[model samples]
Target chain A: MVAAPCCAADDCIIEARGLTKEFSGFVAVCNVDLRVRRGHIHALIGPNGAGKTTFFNLLTKFLAPTRGQILYRGEDITHAKPAEVARRGLVRSFQLSAVFPHLTALENVRIALQRTHPGTFHFWKREATLAVLNDRARELLELVDLGAFAAVVAVELPYGRKRALEIATTLAMDPQLMLLDEPTQGMGHEDVDRVTALIKQAAAQRTVLMVEHNMHVVSRIADTITVLQRGQIIASGSYAEVARNPLVMEAYMGAPDGELRGGH
Target chain B: MRAQPVLYSLAVLFALAVPLLGIYPVFMMQLLCFAMFACAYNLLLGFGRMLSFGHAAFFGFAAYATGWLVSAHGWGPGFAILAGVAAAALLGLVIGALAIRRQGIYFAMITLALAQLVYFVCLEAPFTGGENGLQGIPRGTLFWLLPLHSDVVMYYVVLATFVAVFALIRRVVHSPFGQVLKAIRDNEPRAISLGYEINRYKLLAFVLSATLAGLAGSLKALVFGFVTLADVQQSTSGDVVLMTLLGGTGTFFGPVLGAGIVVTLQQYLSDVVGGWVTAIIGATFVACVLAFRRGIVGELTLLASRARRTLRPARG
Candidate 1:
């Protein structure tokens, strides 16, 4: 492991330099340098095809970059495996609800918590040994207000509840940096509100970098917002600053005359 | 759910009494061996969600290894069988390493192709007796005391082996590691993001399955007093897959039940129909897939769970 460079601005927990991803001749994420500070809610908002997901994947090492380097806590992790990156605490909660459908909601959280437990390979021990994690799993379930549905299979969960379960499972990882990709992609108003609150609670103790289309959600919790259009960062600042930027407004509404709607 | 332990105990008692109850000892032994094989296969296909088409390589090669050792080297049956299991595990590591690089149908095809390679190797190998196979292999005494020369004695030994391995598998399926395998099977990307080395878990599950399958094969060799190329054939691989699907993929008893039904069907059908036996089995599989997609045991479990849910009042 290469030692991270000592810099005065060490609050930048994740730093990407010249990060680029290309598909054939088309560049999906072009020459992006991003620095996410510690313990802040950072939002990556963009119109469709803005490559927010691609950049997220690049940071999490789900997809290798065609060029550039990713440094986590100053350590170069551009070549780390997804699992390896997760092990180092930069975990990702995927779009389309990443919870295991067949497992019970409690089991889903317990499985995530099992990663921190020793003897994860102990196949001979009575399953009662794992009952010890039930309380913690239950706590996480209650944290997401799904405590009553602990026994319900994940697949049977309501859409909003499933996203909450996903966040609960993500929280069980106790990650230093959590990447949530479109956590509220297909939800009604009620679910969106519940999940937005859940994400805020989940982000309380960690750094969060989320890709969201709902400007309301981005404005509500984001300390910093980066607006991207056509694979390039058009504006990066406080939510108010980015929301007022003419370029960011043009990127969202397409023309000068259209009002910048909060929900998309 | 509360009655499960009693049901399992009753099942165990029934299995133990099979030899004493005047059931055909040889036939029962064969059933037990195949049931174990199905259970082993279930460990991968059912739990790990890995479909291997070349499982016969492990099953048949172990038989050959045990038969070669006991007949040629004069090793005791107990030690010879252990050697067979070891050989299968070694083969599993090699095959699993290559097979797991791909997913879904590709994994199945790789295993199938590799098993065919084992089949041809068996056909050409000197000690395996090629087409004739190794015959008249001794049913050496278990632990140098319990004479396996008698079919009744051998039946008990095979039954005991099956029970022990089955229990071990049950333990594995309920263990935390097993839970992780289920998580991986349900959603692999999420499992990886949870910091699981999924391929390692998959490889381990594959090896365990192969080792248990080897155990079944070695026992079959001892009971039948022969090791045949038929055991290593692609058809045998297909048979286990059929049995697993027929019984249930992920359920604990599905594979065993499926194996029992398939082996019984084959035994009876071949006597009268001979050439038509394969077609009949194929038809049965189609019926099962169409109507019982969850497999026999899986559907039964679902029914049982539903019954329990209905009978019990809702709780907070």
Candidate 2:
């Protein structure tokens, strides 16, 4: 495991060194080293099949790496379970919206907050005791602009609203580093703008690492952007710096040289 | 749905009046035992989304344990029943740990396979009396106070226990643990991502469900004065599954109504149909599954909600 040379141990919330994942003989994610700085909206952008999601899964410990080291807050966590990593405040949201569809919007957030309660695993205790969490749960709903729809079941929510609710549930975990997988995927312009702004607000105190397909959202919010193609990092810098790079332009627009512009 | 309280009270009143109306107390006790079994099964299959096909192992094992304790060892009914429940819980812990490693149909198959192993043990064990079963299980006094020799007294005892167990199941269904179970059922990956170790929850539900099913078995052994091979048979597990599904899988009172219908059908139809009773019950289950995909209670709840929606506009 190589220690990050440029940044101090405390400066990075999570660091990956020599991360690799293989399915049979197919290499999904090759040896890659990356650092997510504390309190920054770091966006990982890649073309289709560029191994961005695979890298995210490896970091979350959902899929064990073929060979690599993952450090969370300078501690080796390559062998941690997904839930264990989550409890340590490294949380993730799926590419698809991950709200509990049958539960109400308020209940969705409450489930995330329930881990802190003493009686979370008490099967015999009355569920009414969880009413204490309702106030904080509602506050989270309001944070995502879902206060009015608190009583509505998640299944009935609009697609973009469901994404917002997913974010609300993620926020309820109070994660130190939030890994959002395509937070604005399959959204209308209005919804995307709203969610992009929501992510900015959510990242005020916490660090965020997101895999995004929308160039506009990434350019607007991402402090540092990394471009990946064919299972390897092709370029890493600010949006403008990476956007102008000839390789990134070629990977994105299939052109040898051009300025990367707007949503893909 | 709003009429639930009234409906429940009426049902309880009917149950109380059954013996007075000269409808055999023994039959009613049997019905209550099966109802408890179905409710316990529903706790796992309905709420936890675990379809355990080997629940008969717990049920039958407990009946034999309780029977041996009460008849041979002359143990009190209370202690024997508790012992039976504990034995079932231990078996559940072992089976659940293994079964939970697989999901969906594989999990069901594991339970069925394990329960069959228990069945063969019962079939060959010296204590189970092989094919004849452990007969003449005496229903001892309750806490050494009230004699359970009379069918009427025993009926009331079974009724009280059924009510208490039913209430406990209700409490469990609505608890914070139940909330997490539902979350796991709805979306397991999301639940895991939220930091829940879902396997532990599933195992606990399994053990609790098995213990309650064992309670029903122990009660049946005491009431019937025999522990039969029928108790541990695979059909017994299928019967409870049918009862839960026919009544409604997830609804609170669905399994109870399902058990009532099934038990009543078996009791009344056996006189007329004789050897065809099983065939008739099978046909009825098929018809119910085809007609009510959500089960009787679930369909009723849906219709009630639709009616409420139409009525709200009229009220305005």
Candidate 3:
């Protein structure tokens, strides 16, 4: 473990002490402690069932933790309603990049923007006629470099563009803390780089807690890395520190031999 | 776009002139009422992706409620109908809250089970006249005195309501909320990840659909002058599903087409085949599920789109 001193205030933004979630009789996520700071890109990397996604789910209030306390922005937010969590500005993205496929890309983001907007029920005008909402949606679309595909059905967009649109939809909520589960889970290397850059860009403004399998992506972009296996955070430090630890290598990171870390 | 609009205009024109065409106008009135009911049912099953077997609870409850108000208490037809709509929406709120906890096939089973409960209550309830229904349900008056007993006048009133509701359904479907409902249908978990409260949206849709269905049922009771037990039957619930599917899933006008087809089939099949409409309706449901999942309107929409694409001048 690299003995980098931890600043209590900066390090405790997402303090998870003994977080655990069990599905039926099986323990999908074991007792684990996780901490991520504001304005930092925190990557949670592990093999397929290393509990990274479960940990993220617990934080996002999608799944209630059987035993754990998840503190977001210094308040215990364990098991709050998903919308309440969203209203508090902690949002998530799915591995499959959940987007409204039938809707135009602009409409997808428009709905997202509507989720956070109070004036959403004005029925007289069409959604496209809602000038304020449309401009903001387009701005978010432009931010993701999907301005050209704004009018196209999301289903018609290529895979990489869909992922970008998902990011834009999440951004439309103006999330203070974003939880992304495998943002590049199914992307090619080129798409992975693009998504990683977007994540990095997003992290500059707020906080990003992501679950990644790719060591190279984590190593390249993560300001801090936490390795989990059997639900516990076995290793937590800078990428170099966690990447070097033998326990992390054996339990989580695989061989780091450049063949398949599952990382980009 | 042009073709669809023209087809829509023709449908509207036909709906307007049906009573004037002198083709047993009462049948047309019944057709309009059921068309609106089926459309309301489709609003959920087609777009919301929720198959409700208890929709009859709303339809029947509204029928009796509206019938009682207009016939026994001498309430205005419009006010009584509105009351029925509100009651069904409230019922939908309660039922939807419980039913949405489980999803897919379990949802269908739960709704069926709940509708059975409602059926039994109607069987014993005093206000429901204990399955005899609230009869002598005076067709009321156009404006409380104009007397809508004339078949043609009543038919046109039903016609106007049907057209308005159809337009309302169209407006809602193309709205932002409708898009969200479709998003939920295709991928609910994904919609949730996008910060949509899936259950809330679903409940709202269920209530809205039920309210509109109740509106149709209320109008139906007023048209026929009675609230029959047939309104709330499990078969009626299935009838709406069949209608929506035969018309088309997720297409705005498919349910209307399906409803018209089912009504016509019931009339003709009962008259010609005699004692076989049940078997035929069952067969039609199976065939639709197995082969014609897109129904008539859905197929037409697909054809229209294909034609539009082909008609496009070869892009350079």
In terms of DockQ, which candidate is strongest? 1
**Tens digits of per-residue lDDT for model 3, A7-115:** 2366646777688889898898888877788788888877778787777778878889899777777677776777677877888888876788888899888877776
Candidate 1 chain B minimal-lDDT segment of 10 residues: B307-316
DockQ of 1: 0.81
What's the CA error at residue B51 for candidate 3, in Å? 1.7
Runs off by more than 4 Å, candidate 2 = A1-8, A257-259
- Candidate 2's DockQ is 0.75
Chain B TM-scores, listed for every candidate in order, come to 0.97, 0.98, 0.95
Tens-place lDDT per residue, model 2, B1-316, is 5699999999899998988899999988999999999999999999899999999999999999999999889999999999999999999999999999999999999999999999999999988999999998889898988799999889999999999999999999899998888888888888888899989989999999999999999999999999999999999999999999999998888999999999998999899889799998899899988999789999999999899999999999
Compared with the true structure, what per-residue lDDT tens digits does model 2 show for residues A110-162? 99999878876799999899999999999999998999999999999999999
What TM-scores do the predictions have? Answer: 0.96, 0.96, 0.93
Candidate 1 local lDDT, B1-316, one digit each (tens):
6777998899889988887798899999999999999999999999899999999999999999999999999999999999999999999999999999899999999999888888989999888998899999999787779999999888888888898999999999899888998999999999999999889999989999999999999999999999999999989999999999999999888898899999998998899999899999999999999999999888988899887788778652
Fnat of candidates, each listed: 0.83, 0.75, 0.31
Whose TM-score is higher: candidate 2's or candidate 3's? 2
Best by lDDT: 2
Assess each prediction's global lDDT (C-alpha) against the native.
0.90, 0.93, 0.82
